[model samples]
Target: MTLVNLATVLSKAKEGKYAVGAFNATDLNTARGIVEAAEQEKSPIILQFAESHSKYISLEQAANMYLDLATRACVPICVHLDHGENFNTIIRAIKLGFTSVMVDASLKPFEENIQNTKEIVKIAQSLGISVEAELGVMNAEDGSGSLDYNTMDDTYTSVQEAKEFVQKTKIDALAIAFGTVHGLYKKEPNLNYERIKAIQNCTDMPLVMHGGSGLSNEEYQQSVANGITKINYYSTMSFEVTNGLRNYLNSNSDAFLFDVDAKTIELVKNNIAEKIQIFGSSNKA
Candidate 1:
């Protein structure tokens, strides 16, 4: 009953001066952690399964799992397919009941990205599903090789183009690249606050900032103040989960290996709770 679509909640966040945390989860454990943390904090959360995760499971299976959890959850849960590339994948996600889908054709030519995203929006909005599209190029660091077409690694989202894209694509949210990458940053990347402000000024649509995991607290709050309504977080969650298990195994050795699952879940929950608070979504459900 608490399950909801991304647009409604994100729009609320836009007016409220807060940002919803979109956590990418690969398995039931991570999904549970995200939901539990959100419920405990009374924050609206987005549980997303990226297209890369489909390598191990089908879109139908992932969608059903998230839907089942969201239906029984205490707080709003938006099930999303993150960084979906093609029509077939997006169609599969929609058929499987994804509440939101990201059509990431940012690497393609501007006209092509617009056309592809527009096609998705046409279909998704008809089904009451919100669509998110990326405008700028971010280097693919996860070694997925899916973003090899992204030749403009240093390219940032054009403010003028962003206005036109929003007007043309009619997407619910726009993920703009403001100097952040996919994985962990080797150095502290400077976010273009001025660019973000410009884009926000030109468009009323909710803006999203990817590579949210490694940004400083000031950077996060600054993004929200400037008009970012949804922030995508993933690498930090994965890092915390793995680090928690590693520490647990090192301490437990032979006897308590099976208990690592609980510890991992706890770690993930704690990490998400902290992120929720940072995003200022806590108690905003």
Candidate 2:
């Protein structure tokens, strides 16, 4: 029964200098896997449902499942909404008991992004819910689609603008774009640790890293050392789960659907546990 808000866990991460893993849950088994990993590692975790994933599962269904899992978990778990584009959808998620919500207005003009995020922060903060907003646009868009690796430099977050955005919006966390994209990278990414340090110095609060998957272990540690306190990881975890299912199917051609589901849960749990260890959140609970 250690369900908590995003800021609560992030504050601890900021103090400990370890980034918490914010893993996206695509289904019930995936959600279960994330929590199980956290509990096993004794780490605090963020269980998030992305807006684009709505096509696979409704918001209400995900919210209900997340809340139930959080309440029954031993380690601290924050139920969050990832990349909530529409105002109504973000509000709806808050009302449905999400501990944290990310208002992604980065695609709009700077001033407009600030204004949009301010509106949500005003409401979410009052109810003791944490609000996270993105500062710069990612090359791969919101988690999936075309990836323009060539234009990645164009989306690097400006340190000055990041300071102003945090001051204006009063958000609990800031998701800054450096070199990471939302989905798989076409080539090895050249991350901007200096920019991460600069933003951390100015904001003096928790900083979030989107497109957290596909990076090397050293990259993750470097990002955390440079002041990334929350890392949004998904694509790689999803990929690993699919591969695990495929391998199981290959070995047992007559495997039942329930057997595959059980294997998915196990595979997902193992993958997330490995990530939790890599992020240096293990034993941080």
Clashing pairs in 2: none
Clashing residue pairs in candidate 1 (N, C-alpha, C atoms within 3 angstroms): none
Q: How accurate locally, in lDDT, is each candidate? A: 0.87, 0.92
RMSD values for the candidates in order, in angstroms, are 3.2, 1.9
Tell me each candidate's TM-score: 0.94, 0.96
Residue 6, model 2: lDDT of 91
**Model 1 residue 262 lDDT?**
72
Please give the distance, in angstroms, between residue 82's alpha carbon in candidate 1 and its true position after superposition.
0.3
In model 2, how large is the Cα lDDT of residue 150? 52
Candidate 2 regions with alpha-carbon error over 4 angstroms: 141-151
> What does candidate 1 score on TM?
0.94
Model 1 regions more than 4 Å off: 141-154, 255-258
In terms of lDDT, the poorest run of 10 residues in model 2 is 141-150
- lDDT, residue 116, model 1: 98
